[model samples]
Target: MKTRLFRMGLAVLSLAAGFTLAGVVGPAMAQQNVTLALPAQSLLFAPAYIAAERGYFREAGIEPKIVYVAGPGVLTAVLGKSADFAMISGGIQIAAAVRNQKLVAIANTQDRFTTDIVVRKPVADKLGAVPPGDALARIRALKGLTIGIDAVNGLPHSFLRYLARKAGMNPETDFTITALQPQAMVAAMKSGTIEAMAFSPPFSLTAVNDGGALWITGPDVDLPEMKTFPYNVVLVRPDYCQAEAAACRGFTTAIGKAVALMRSDPAASLAALGKTFDRMEPEALRQSFAIFAKYTRTDLGLTEDMYRNAVAFDRAGGVIPETAAVPPASELYAPSLGR
Candidate 1:
């Protein structure tokens, strides 16, 4: 791991000194300015960063700007026309669709459900002998602990609830979930304010560096329900996608290219993203990218089965009410939006 991290770090440093890997690879077209809103700076959105850094967005004739906001604000950014696109959890989009909101998921970047349940090192030491592969056992051990999440109904919170329920515990009463930013969660864990946290890296990696241990890593846990689910997806207003078809398609294509890049060349992909995560430790960034690249979608298409699985996950987590009128995947997802 250390060797790979060092190699990737050097590769990225090379990019700083005029390493040209064809920033412009596609047809010449008019560049359109586009804004994208993201909920957090998790490695789950590595595709977006890589696309911008490696000039995939430029190749697709797009000048992209990424804006960070707290949970649910990403939805607001798209809805209010502040951003042309937003990368958000599939569960949030599904919940909005059930309410007849005008939203469409153009492409799924991170296709698998991912987050890490990290506990302080001391806490982990107490839960002895739990097999790393046994996701249920890992989750069962988290019962009655104060777990930190970034949002109230965001992916981390929903995922934690889902895991808790699957562990045969009452998600409502078995544990206390406190909402805090990723950085704050780390501080809380260090201060003993929270026992554990559930979030995506490099926050999880940061916690681990600060005397925390992984309880359940979403990518490593091979759960049937999480497979094929849309964890990080590019969302747009259907009307905007129709009116500005070129921009939408170009943006989607850029993301798809980034996804392909991540799979085809790890060092180059890491280099492309290194600029975005300059402050992160090289090792932690490499590990985080590894987790993200493992399950990023190659096709970028949003299938009916995928949306159905996401809906099921949200429903199980109580993010979507059982009585809500859920539309068919075809109504919510724009299969033609992506290249």
Candidate 2:
């Protein structure tokens, strides 16, 4: 009887040991640490902010550290390995992918071109007060003026080209586009160096209120080409994704929850955003978030039409060679991590 009892005890102990070894029940593991790269620390990326401040990242066992890159330089963060994931514009992402930069978009950001076209007071005066609703007329007024952009071939520049084309003017021949950093852009407009600029808020707000510029937000106008065009996106590197898929997935899932929070609770969303945009007034920030969020989707899903529009816009605007083949969704966005 003693020998039988001993054998049974040994079997039970061995089974318990096997369960622990197989990780069926054990002490919790350390949280996976990751760095997320953001193009700018603006309210334009509310979902990401929602995830971090709302404790979604922590809940998902991810110790997410945000690293900001200036000049909308998020893609470089991934290329340089400064971040595991990057939130940037799809235009930039598609252009980079065409250049063989290895990146996979995990989620889509804002579909509408959220940037506001701010025309200097002096510039608007020269056009003799066109109606606010007159998009084509305002676009026609853009001809023969010097416009400022963040970079030579960046979004502002590309948008100028697209707008010009839609309005039946050649951007290259009709208007002079110049590179002026945000700080310099304001100054240049004040000094009468550049007549107008396409910028995102709170800079857009500043241009209108402080600089006495006319704010013509793109979405308010009818622009078929820019509608539902993938602008901002969350992207990941394949190597890191394959290695830390669970963490990556957790990060993406957290953003989805953030989207819900932003939709359901504006006050909470703005409260969370206060830290990021410290100087921005609560009301102004709230208004801005409402305007941009109207087009933002929680899911990062991108259709072939989205991809096609981006590629066509870039190719048509001469951002890339017309001959460059646009990579499909499989090459451009990683299917596994976000899923």
Which candidate number has the best lDDT?
1
Question: lDDT per model, in order?
Answer: 0.84, 0.76
Query: How does model 1 fare in lDDT?
Result: 0.84
Q: What are the per-residue Cα lDDT tens digits for candidate 1 across 29-119?
A: 6689989998888888888998999888988888988998777778878988999899988888888777776588888887776688999
lDDT of 2 at 211: 67
Q: Count the backbone clashes (under 3 Å) in each candidate.
A: 0, 2
Candidate 2 per-residue lDDT over residues 208-236, each given as its tens digit: 66565654677776765566777877788
Name the weakest run of 10 consecutive residues (lDDT summed) in model 2.
22-31
